[model samples]
Target: MKLFADYHTHTIYSHGTGTIMDNVNAAKKKGLKEIAITDHGLRHFTYGVKREKLKRMREEIDEINENNKDFKVLLGLECNIISSDGQIDLDDEAMKYMDIVLLGYHMMVRLKGVPSYVHIYGRHYLSKISKSMAEETRQSNTDIMINAIKKYKVNIITHPGARISMDTGRLAEAAAKTGTALEINSKSNIMTVDYLKVAAGHGAKFVINSDAHKPEDVGNFRNAIKLAEMAGLTSHQIINAVKS
Candidate 1:
């Protein structure tokens, strides 16, 4: 069997309704080579990973790593894009301990209302559509995301098209330039086929993620694979965390 891995997941520290041990146990049962615990960054209005929780999560991951030598566990953050200007919620100090930092825009955090671009295109459109000011946010996100990769050398960016939007072409361009991978998140609404095709067309690398909140959800990569094949992604184009 191909080595399976899921790089976007949450634990109880995230208020994710599951324990860290539950996630690890799930990974073991699913036969995954690795699972990344990427709980929401500190900006989540109601439930976010605070410094203390992150420390504890790391300690837990360390213990899991020692015990479960058969599997690799990654510590990560699904940092919220706090504003349209694209600034991530975590400060420099908070990001130091993380293995990966994935950025996303949340409705509760990023937008006050549907931006004009989304409104004009229809609210359901998954591609990034933002006002000029929102571009600052998008650009800020782009810059911040790119800079995080440069600064911390984080491996991947989480779902690019959640509540926030960006120009896929530009994002692909950035991903290519930065050597970072963009995610096809299965747990969120599937990445639009058009966006996937456009991204692959640009030679951007990709990551398939479940964004799993529960242990049972860990290795569910079905929708992600469908989008990948639809986009004509080959194994070489995917950046699986467990693989080289």
Candidate 2:
């Protein structure tokens, strides 16, 4: 299997070390056909892209697309799941500027309300300490993620089992139904081989991404590719890959 695109990449708009152009250049250098400039959403406390800058980022990407006929750059946001009810940090206004949407569970997001805080964050941490809460939290997390997939036009779920614990089979079932690909992130080891196998068994599609924070790291899918291979995933099951 060979990947043709790197859908989950970061830029200076968020916590990344490179500009959008820098990442684009890096992807090109790595011989990738396409890349997405997926910065953090507006709610990430430390690294979220400023809402006002969305327009500017859109313009930048447009110009790049105009100049390069052989390559594609998609403007997307690595949006946060802000509430237990599956409300993400993205809105219709933000959606206008996006070519794709990538949602994931991340810590330190400005959530919907206190209720969301208690349900999404409080319980998550509490589960770490209490064995009884672990199963409940895992179920709740899976339910919340499935809700989000049903609620939004999410193209991908970045690193499903990364920041929190979730039932991979359950989440994958919902993702397959909704046509949302689960990410195999190269930057983190959260998506284990076991998780990949479980998710794939539910007929869910996948994407291998660098999750690159630096320009030079763009299109670096080695780790993710190895894990996917270990899980016996073929190109047909991966959105960005092709049979070689």
Best model number under TM-score: 2
Error of 2 at 218 (Å): 0.3
| Residue 127 shift from truth in candidate 1, angstroms | 13
Q: Write the per-residue lDDT of candidate 2 for residues 103-189, one digit (tens) a residue.
A: 998998999989999998999999999999999999999999999999999999998887888888899999999999999999888
lDDT of 1 by residue, 124-169 (tens): 2322354545655545445544555555444677888556555666
Evaluated at residue 195, the lDDT of candidate 2 is 82
Clashing pairs in 1: 84-137, 85-137, 86-137, 86-141, 128-165, 128-166
lDDT of each: 0.71, 0.93
Q: Highest lDDT: give the candidate number.
A: 2
User: Looking at model 2, how many pairs of residues clash?
Assistant: 0
lDDT of 2: 0.93
The per-residue C-alpha lDDT of model 1 at residue 199 equals: 85
